[model samples]
Target: MTRVVFLLVPQVHLLDLAGPAQVFSTAADLGLDYRTEYVADREDVPTAQGLPLRAGTEWPDLESGDLVLVPGWRSPKTAGGPRLTDAQVAQVQAHHARGGTVGSVCSGAFALGQAGLLDGRRCTTHHSLQDELARRFPAATVERDRLFTTDGRVVTSAGIASGIDLALHLVAVRHGPAAAAQIAREMVVYARRGGDAAQDSAMLRHRSHLSDAVHRVQDLIDVRFAEPLRLADLASAAGVSERTLTRRFTESTGLTPLRYQSVLRLERAEHLIAQGSPVESAARAVGFGDARMLRRLRSARFQS
Candidate 1:
């Protein structure tokens, strides 16, 4: 069995703890080898929602897993009494040093950051802490809009409900698509989102940039997913080479320019389709020049 530890902190968000636990439990019921336990620096930590959760194991023996999950606290922006200390930090770092994967939910990225496990890695946290997380961990790529991010041994996620999505994705990664789908069906959530989907929804945004040129290009793309967007036009307006634009675009947003634009188009098209627009019209509205191509794309995306 794969041992998964939930590292609880004071004033933890109940949903953050429950979301991933449910996913793992569902996976086990569907025949994946998994076991879950709670661990913490203290034995009784009061939660933000007015209850106390026990710290199941001592800190020394907490390293029991192929995985360690740090669920977010309710108000991570504020310093609270049950906050993880430097000692707990060291324990997690040591576990990852031995090749165990560390997973985090919402503001749980802060714990991982404290542990130095997130240094020089791609990660994310709840949108509320994007600036603070980036400021605290200069070496890490802090993504605000991504559903979740996994870089090597560390995985981080966006706010609240996204924890379940990240857990289901790990199920897909560790077990297989069939297993993940089964778990998602049981949970009544969508199956795991593709990496590109995660990037498009949460990681890429109009406001998260340092360069005016990149911002201009991204803003234009955000508004005009229905228009024909050309690399040359974007690069010309931004006053950079296509290669430089591509590199900067990916560096800032973690997505290639073309793929980023495609996501915007697809998402817009999906909204229209869901609203009962004719598929052909929706495709054209989203810059797909051919109705036949839209049909093919729609067919690939959804069976119905």
Candidate 2:
């Protein structure tokens, strides 16, 4: 079983703690060997949102396959005292030294820094804390405006809801994209929200709009993106004329239907290629006739 340990702190954000917990818990429900455990400095822990929690003072046995995540807590802007004791910080250090993965959410990055884990790692936290994190940990690379970042096994998120994204990413890395995708769908989260630094994929990027017709069309396209889709069929699915569909899709997503499809195809093809698929093979897998189109799309993407 893969053990996921939450190193809970006083005043931990409920969502930051719960989001990742839910992901792994649901994964366990889906038959994955995930055993989630919570540990704290004390038996009773108070949250920033006034929710009280209970945890064990003693930590569990860990292996290299396990993960230790420190969820963020509330802190003052001014120089406040250290949140974690030196002993707790040493535990985090030892965990990484033993080759186990470690991570943080929001102000939790501060604890990792106190442990010296953030040194030379690419990490992130809540946007408001970016400057302070960088100011304190001059050795760490604080990624600004990022949803999440992974420098080797030391993953981090911007906190709160972004914690869910980081958890999904970890699931995807160890398990597979299919596992993460399944979990995201079950949780109603948009999967593959672009790169680590961006919001998400084209589907997620365009999903913020609340147009029912556009969403229906997008749903159909998401399912059959690897097929030869015609405008008429998309319009039929959206219950609109081809012209109207084109306008709505563009206005909602900032891309025409065909452009959106091309973006999706390119995104999928890139993943396949990253997994060592040949360019031609990846192109064909995403419904392209050949590598020529894929290459052009890639070139245009890079050039612009």
Off by over 4 Å in 2: 76-82, 194-304
Compute each candidate's TM-score over C-alphas.
0.66, 0.67
lDDT (Cα, 0-100) at 200 in candidate 1: 41
Q: How accurate locally is residue 55 in candidate 1, as Cα lDDT from 0 to 100? A: 77
Model 1 ranges with Cα > 4 A deviation? 59-65, 80-82, 195-304
In order, candidate lDDTs are 0.79, 0.87
Per-residue lDDT over 97-205 for candidate 2, one digit per residue giving the tens place of the 0 to 100 score = 8999999988899988888888998988888888989998999999887899888779888988888988988899889999988998989885445335453457787
Model 2 misses residue 135 by how many Å? Answer: 0.2
Model 2 whole-model lDDT (C-alpha atoms): 0.87
**Each model's Cα RMSD:** 11.3, 5.5
Best by the TM-score measure: 2
Q: Candidate 2, residue 40: CA error in Å?
A: 0.8
